[model samples]
Target chain A: MMSDNSDIDKYYDVVVVGAGPAGIGVGILLQKLGINHIILEKTSIGESFRKWPIETRFISPSFTGNFFKMPDLNAITPDTSPAFTLLTEHPTGEDYVEYLENLAKYYDLPIKTEVCVDTVQKKADSFVLTTNKGEYKSTYVIWAAGEYQYPKTNAFEGTHLCTHYSEVDSFSDLEGDEHIVIGAYESGFDAMVSLIRARKVVTLLDDGDYLNLVKSDSSYSLAPFTRDRIEYVADLFDYYTETKVTSVEFVNDTYLVKTANGQTFTSPQKPINCTGFASSLTLVKESFEFKNDYPLLNDFDESTKTSNLFLVGPQVKHKNALFCFIYKYRQRFAIVAEKIAKRMKVPSQAIEKAIQGYKDNNFYLTDLSCCDDECTC
Target chain B: MMSDNSDIDKYYDVVVVGAGPAGIGVGILLQKLGINHIILEKTSIGESFRKWPIETRFISPSFTGNFFKMPDLNAITPDTSPAFTLLTEHPTGEDYVEYLENLAKYYDLPIKTEVCVDTVQKKADSFVLTTNKGEYKSTYVIWAAGEYQYPKTNAFEGTHLCTHYSEVDSFSDLEGDEHIVIGAYESGFDAMVSLIRARKVVTLLDDGDYLNLVKSDSSYSLAPFTRDRIEYVADLFDYYTETKVTSVEFVNDTYLVKTANGQTFTSPQKPINCTGFASSLTLVKESFEFKNDYPLLNDFDESTKTSNLFLVGPQVKHKNALFCFIYKYRQRFAIVAEKIAKRMKVPSQAIEKAIQGYKDNNFYLTDLSCCDDECTC
Candidate 1:
């Protein structure tokens, strides 16, 4: 439900920024709790998902096993499955956006689109969010502006000479016969595969041997979907491990890519940078204390420095656990909503009933100890 | 560990037949409960998995989210993941065998391969299983022999003229370029896709419109993985829905497949029948009362007519819930084990502690009500 700037309330018990999976997820919880809340999206629901490269598919496969208490990995809520809705295992960016939009409509979540929150400031008792449309105040603020839109473009010297992976509308539309892809992670391999499939030769430079490094956690390792895609095209690409790209130099319509290993490669077109994304937390850096570039979060995911100000989405980190993926970060949605609702003096029984489904499924993860264990087999 | 036939005990509390996922899964639970039991297999471990067609991959995808309480869908045990062990999402039959072998070795399960149970006769208080090696007696008999190896060859008239879907070693190795595949379920679609990819012309005769039928339960519908595989090859072949094959006839070195709709398709080679399989429960049909060809069982999946006789694996059905997939039936492992362990008077705490991980990780599903809800979006 899109509300006009004038129609939106000036104040709410909770205000969620961004209409991505994290924002929509937590907003559903708050709505269920009967808490006054609004989700403000800079663009529209699932804007980041809609902006994904055309060839890019979700590395994590989706399956409808929600009835067995195992929700689809890509589902925002336990009751919905992307696979069932989209009828595809690896939903495209557009397909996922449809899922998010469906959720927003089904839940009748109060959302205001095209309202960009430029800055957030804490007053004596409330958070004042200054948006492009107008000012809004909330007792609790959930910063769910995800990381995908904020690409890490300034990673190396002369990085602007290259195209970031996120900016590509489609790999097949690239004007070059050959391309040099920097950073050999999920996005890197994805770009390389798409290029190769488009009948182009590609070179991949990796800072680490991600292909050989297998971790028990899907969060740390290359997903099986990526591995499967790369397996068929492994012989078609030039892959250099431990060769971190230093910079790209454009000379005479040629791009010379230099690496940390003192090796240089030439490409006719601008090299593609797949060095990953910067956290959206950069926007609200002053609200939370920093530890190793991650915002400090308490047990309830509230900011350590600012009271009632919370962090959701991929930026949420507790110890070694990186809540980056939808499955990982989604677990914290209820915890954030519950804390805000409880503090608002919502009835205890109502809160319990509202969050019971999340608790029953793996959505509400409070115990961080289980996140670090390696698979025995 | 493989036990010698000479060292096998003549008497036990439980004797689990077949060393596939069902038997092995239940055996682990029984061992954890400190119950005296032995799992007997006619062949080596994962014999059914080993027998799958060379090009066939698991319809259900596997991901290692075990730490977050979501175990791999194909994993028999809660702690183990096929994706982690095999490092693939849709593991081939051979790859899956490796995972099953690893689980068997890791748990040090009491497995006696090459010992086929010929006859299971109830002898007053105990059930006597007469095997190829010798006679063994047990208070409880868990018939976990899966249905894959048991192909339904007599589904139609003159079906012997055609090759059953289970009999094909590889679709690429088939004798002719043109083939007729009967029954358009998972196996039928798999055969068609593999043959088409191998540069063959194929015609499919489906008994029902499975492609158009969408069910909330994965067991009742084609999996997303199957849908993805067929998406690329959908236009390459002729798919005849609501066309049931009635008979196959051999005439002048050519085979003719007759359908119920008065359609006759000709092929140089024998037609492929993928009508599906009869339950392995056929072996001990007299022990259990039958309803709609499914063995009638109580809440514990025990044969209603017989005492101390239980059922496990894909053959298990409760109302509309068809527990045919590994993820579906594995939930009953703990329930069956707990009941048998309790009857043997094992300590409640030990059983509880042993099955705690299963309960927490969705390995134990006692509530069947959740199995029927449809996805909202």
Candidate 2:
């Protein structure tokens, strides 16, 4: 790979290979501890947030989405009511991205954008990472690039007729009147909703169970604010359910999806594969013995097969279901950051307090209702 | 007294009077628990907040200033930082009032405004509250009129020539070119700053024992903001040494003050009094035995001298060192509210948790750090 000479061969206490939420979160915690580290992003800071569709927003409540030991929303503005200023709403993708940018700027985390890490290998008492920009040696390495970095498509015939969810961030590049979204999960449903909002017919293809945005009691089963957001979107789009699209074909300037229900729906919109991405460790997959496409990890989040390598973020979900959302990611990231900080002997209360605060949110907001306005509980 | 036929004297499970933070807070808790209660306010909801100076803003931090059970700032508006939207670096009083109004509306608190209670006398089974609109008989009564209702001035010779701090909301109100602000406390400092900003030869007069806003560090002190506000008038005024204004005389086209230092400072501007207000409980004081000229309360926030009657807000601090600041009011209000709610058999959590949250100001914005572009925090 071609190399850039910027800060070549610099050694760091910890090196994180992503500038997304997980990486930036770790960087913020580490920065607060005065730890010497660097965040290398192949694209830009909050690249994933930037890639989300215009109508896309955080699926979680804003209260739990803040960075570790960072400023909460109330500190930024005084006129906002605590409920209105803190926890009762969801923000759009563009706004969420702007918020991330503001957070990154506030902490002044040393993030190096456009520095793509090629491989991370273990060395004695440390880890060495080779990137397009330079080689970095660190006592600890966190892989937060996440699954979205690599798009995984099935080995079906005419698979090239579809585009992954990450690639369809902007619909302006595509010329289509209708669409077939392949998946019944959040990504696929989100895409179908987006397409429908654009005034196009969308055939959602999935064999799995369908999760309704609205729960039985009209509340969201996810976060409280998620229901509000889903309702807000429902107000803009109408949706019909349970039609599983089995196959799609591109012919006669149209995309045809044959559902399991013996119905063939033809549309001019291109089929988009919002099946989600797999772990982006293709370059190092051959060198490690993987379990279900994920490297085995010990209790400290250190890879069982390797001493210096570690994993965080959604990639950890490849081994377990945690670390997939903001609330969960908050816990998992803090756990790993604390483990690494302890190993490096960094002195700061940021990581421990963050984890404690995260755990506190689950307890206070969900369990206690005595002070809750609606429950008087 | 003539009563409307609609005035059906009915007994309620609980009756909370005053719809400011204290009243609404109790209402929110009661409503959530399926408890039946009626909150009554003599004026609009949060009348005290509404009556604050138009240029006044919350002195407390946004994060810690919210009612218990309300959401944090981030949960309300994800995209907009709370510090920017709710808590300005220095908020005008109007902002807090608007915020309270929004909170009351959002919670749908059942508050009957414009129903001034003439007297609250305890009956055998319930408390009979005689009001201008009707008679309310309830199991419990909460008195939360707060402290800033009546101005307290020393009866010094010629003291009648000065105006109280509450009346001087802005610097534009004064017509003279010079002034003497009597008091070294927040209000005194506030008045002196405003006068100085208005281009007047302003002198701050007080005993100087308990007037200064508490400061531990000059760098992080609220003094700089206070000082900056006053510097706008620095060209015309000078801060006087610790001097007690023994008397004031309104001479022809000027006001003269006799100080402890035997020095008389004459100014063309009318002397402004920054002496703050005392509790508004004169009418009810006769019913209860006085301790230090104030009503004494037991552990349940119940008057030791009277059963079923509770004292909340600044009245508890009457003739005491507390109740002089917003922080103290917030704490005392929560404690009394919880005690009254529990006394009315309205289920509530331990008072410690409610009081604990009140003491921490991070919940509000002005006392918080915003995750913004230039934040060093």
Best by lDDT: 1
Per-residue lDDT of model 2, residues B182-223, tens digit only: 766666767666655555667777655542333222111233
Docking class of 2: incorrect
Q: What is the two-chain DockQ of model 1?
A: 0.80
Clashing pairs in 1: none
Chain B vs. true chain B: TM-score for each candidate?
0.98, 0.74
Chain A vs. true chain A, TM-score per model, equals: 0.98, 0.76
Q: Which stretches of candidate 1 lie over 4 Å from their true place?
A: none
In Å, residue A366's CA in model 1 sits off its true spot by: 1.8
